[model samples]
Target chain A: MPIIINLDQVLADRNMKSKELAEIVGITEANLSILKSGKAKAVRFSTLEAICEALDCQPGDILAFSSPNPSQGGESN
Target chain B: MNLNTFFKRLIDLAFYLMVPIVVFFPGTILYVLMFPEQTIINVNIPYVENGFSGKALLFSMGFFALFLLFFAGLYQMRKFAGLLLKNKLFSQEVVKRTHKTGTFFTACALGSLIFIGINSLFSYEGKISVTFGSSNFNLLLFLLIVGVLFLLLSDAFKKALAIKEENDLTV
Candidate 1:
């Protein structure tokens, strides 16, 4: 859950609808919705590639990682 | 017929056969109770002179309760098989039915052990005897092993369902 999907932001920047992106990427609207909602357990490399190609953006533009407990820092015992 | 079709037909046959057997069990018990002399079930407990004695009735009732539990487990198994036939193999309903089936079987097994212990107290008259040669003992032992195996199978099915759900969510 620490990893976030910024698909909406990327889509907004590209000025394309989710339906249009899904059509180009060859995936169902429900699957696209799952990816956008951050409910997806994983993203296949082929899907990521397809999305990137459809949106004309890098993978980094769609995916972001935010620390869940930033106050605890990265140290582990 | 193909394997899937054959299995489906087999399950359907088993389900239908079990329905009548389950329905007949209570009727059989009632008949045995009403006319003890004409009883088809010969429950021979040592030292109990009459077949319809209080101790014998107690044993029979306890056994009937356990048999009901076993039948309930079988019903759950029928539901599980129905789901499998429909290809809803990894659904929550399948897991729930399997777990319920396992619980019923395990409860029946434990109940049988307790029933045996109580029966032994009356039959042996406070004397502790270990007899492994009895058909009843072997049947109870088999039920216990089968119940444990079903419980293990349920756990495995639960894990498999989790994996399947995770796979489904992966996009």
Candidate 2:
């Protein structure tokens, strides 16, 4: 629940647009936005690996921990 | 992938299931009218309680009504797949159809209830008793299924609509 996506900074550092990163990661622009905006509920490890590899960053650079989110604790509906 | 499209397809599948019963019920009546003595069963009359085709009608429709659940599953899968595609594989209008999923089943449920009501009102001489038949259970089951589907669709629509408000925030 505390996992964070710092894809925005990574993209900027790598001179990559969100769409470009999404294409490289085998995802969609919308999905990239969701991940970048922290609206994504879950992230596949494969996706994280792809992103890390593309931006030449470690997973630690893209992810951080914050206070637990209520929505992340359990099923919403 | 759009939630509306997913919902609409659910509606389509429900109709696919319902259309047959819709025609079958009245068609059976017409068949009966055209051939009244065709339903004959020379069972031994000893210790006989009313046995009627109303239950059969109910069960048949129950099977038909049950198909919407398959649609519901399809909708869920489609929702996930659409999300994966992020509106590229599917469209927004179609995904939101999940909002109206209830209306389709509600109409079918109503039709079923109407059928039950109509059947309840009439008992042809020598026809089976209406009190203890497969019809009664099916009536209740389809009603429950329809009610639940409506509620679920309503909830799903709310989630889909929430996106617009998020858009407002970003804009």
- Please name the candidate that would achieve the greatest TM-score relative to the true structure: 1
**Model 2 Cα lDDT, one tens digit per residue, A1-77:** 46577778877888888877778889877777877887776677898888888899898888887655565463221
Give candidate 2 regions above 4 Å deviation.
A68-77, B1-171
Q: Mind giving the per-residue lDDT tens digits that candidate 1 earns over B43-91?
A: 4544336566776666666767887898888778778877877889888
Candidate 1: which stretches are off by over 4 Å? Answer: A70-77, B1-48, B117-121, B124-134
In candidate 1 chain B, where is summed lDDT lowest over 10 consecutive residues? Answer: B39-48
Number of the top-ranking candidate, with DockQ as the measure: 1
Tell me the interface RMSD of every candidate, in Å. Answer: 0.5, 8.1
Tell me model 2's lDDT, rounded to 2 decimals: 0.59
DockQ of candidate 1 (2 decimals): 0.75
CAPRI-style grade of the A/B interface in model 1:
medium
